[model samples]
Target chain A: MKELSLNILDIAMNSVGAGAKNIAIALDEDDDSLRIVIEDDGCGMTKEQVEKLSDPFYTTRTTRKVGLGVPLFKLAAEQTGGSLDIRSVPVSESEKEHGTKVTAVFNKKHIDHTPLGDLVSTMVTLIQGNPDIDFLFLHTVNGKSVRLSTAEMRKELGDVPLSNGEVLNWIKEYLTEQYKEIERL
Target chain B: MKDKVALREEGSAATRIVVGMATCGIAAGARPVLNTFVEEVSKAGLLDKVMVTQTGCIGICQYEPVVEVYTPSGKVTYVKVTPEKAKRIVEEHIKGGKVITEYTIGNK
Candidate 1:
């Protein structure tokens, strides 16, 4: 993934493929930590399924699914001296509303680099296009928050798909600008 | 300081092509597209005119192979791109300044 956001998108896509209707992402950046949480209401996995998810060869899907997304996320977290936690519930119990939550916490001081810009852009792209799905994103820097609602971008773009060239370019520029602002620090 | 500032300015002025070359993209045949762009730019001796870069994922896995071109003035994204289409992009868009509407995300 170009950034964490891309990784998030990949995982979120898996959730959707698993029949999720809602996905929530929250990012918190502070002097000491950088935290990311992605939650989805989809068909949750069984204990056996969750246990094998980290294996590169395990995938329940039919499409060339050599499951690497979760492993990669775990590696990314570990690289930053961070941790990853994942939990899932089956759809049968929740009536197709399976919930999965993944949290990663990084040591900001140790991991001096993270692709926050790409993360935000990816989130924006996925959230804007999937109107049937709702995504809530909250970004915090030292306790100050900057929020982006996919609902807001959808209204602003007026029927344009988030994947459209114009909208993608706009998101890219927006992300680039946000990174520039962060670089000043 | 002088050299750094000049380099930064030059970097921003160059045309860039970012190919989505991750697994999803590669499975959809982005490698050949990237190779073709590299070859065409080199053969045309327009190395300075364009720079080819690879990116992980564009988030639209369904679109599989994606290519984005960022000129000095505008950015264009082409989705579900193939090698033949990549050649057309190099010949038409990169060299001739015309967008291939059929392959562009805009057409979709």
Candidate 2:
């Protein structure tokens, strides 16, 4: 609960690191349910790799092998009376691919969760900093949806580096504004 | 607490150094680099000249321990930073206008 956003950031970073050109993130909140989904078009993993991805000690990257990201995501969802699903498909026929899509669903009204502000901030931070990967986000409340595309924001900002203080500050303000609209519900 | 608004209004003239301090950065020795910058800045009696802050992941994990310097005109990103390089940055780049060519991503 405390670090749900951090977990999300870590997962998204993995996608970008996998050479994904496009990433999609969705959060749908209704009176009874909340669904979170992250999909990336990166190099897909083999069945064995997917099986080991959540093992907490398996990773192919040069980074540390303590694979806690997916495990943490799964734990967070399960703890909230939810479930997680991960699917991967290979990019090539001969070579085993490693692209992955993860989805977690929760009964929002029942789960003890962190504030939405933190989640949005984490998402914004991830999206702003990674210009090479495009992010698509959709948030739904009571059947109505508010969608945001990082590509659109990038266009508006005119290639401003996400790490630039001005850009980060602007992203924070944008997230704050969007959350305010959500709160009004 | 100084709100982000107040911090922003003060602008780069306020002289803040933001170090990428996430787990990735820390694993690459960003803590020591950050510490060196802070120590050097204080030792030079330039505490008022700069404010040091830490930020989470910047998405360039391959280039961990990135440091950013913001001035009145623009921002400069120094990638794969190190403690020794950080001290040199404070002594040369911050204190003087000349950027340390060796420590920059472009130079590398």
Model 2 agreement with the true structure over A142-166: per-residue lDDT tens digits: 7666666777766765545443444
Worst lDDT run of 10 residues, candidate 1 chain B, spans: B1-10
**What lDDT does the true structure give each of the candidates?**
0.67, 0.68
Top candidate on lDDT is: 2
- The Cα error of candidate 1 at residue B24, in Å, is 5.0
Off by over 4 Å in 1: A60-66, A111-117, A127-132, A153-185, B1-108
Question: What is the i-RMS of every prediction?
Answer: 12.9, 9.6
Alpha carbon lDDT at B85, candidate 1: 84
For model 2, the stretches where C-alpha displacement exceeds 4 angstroms are A59-66, A94-98, A111-117, B1-108
lDDT of 1 by residue, A124-156 (tens): 445433545767767778765656565667676
Query: What tens digits encode model 2's per-residue C-alpha lDDT throughout B4-104?
Result: 22222233445778888555665566655765675677577665557666676777878988999877656888999988789888988888867777777
Return the clash pairs for model 1, or none. Answer: A5-A119, A44-A89
Interface DockQ of candidate 2: 0.07
Among all windows of 10 consecutive residues in model 2 chain B, the one with the lowest summed lDDT is B1-10
Residue B55 error for model 1, in Å? 16
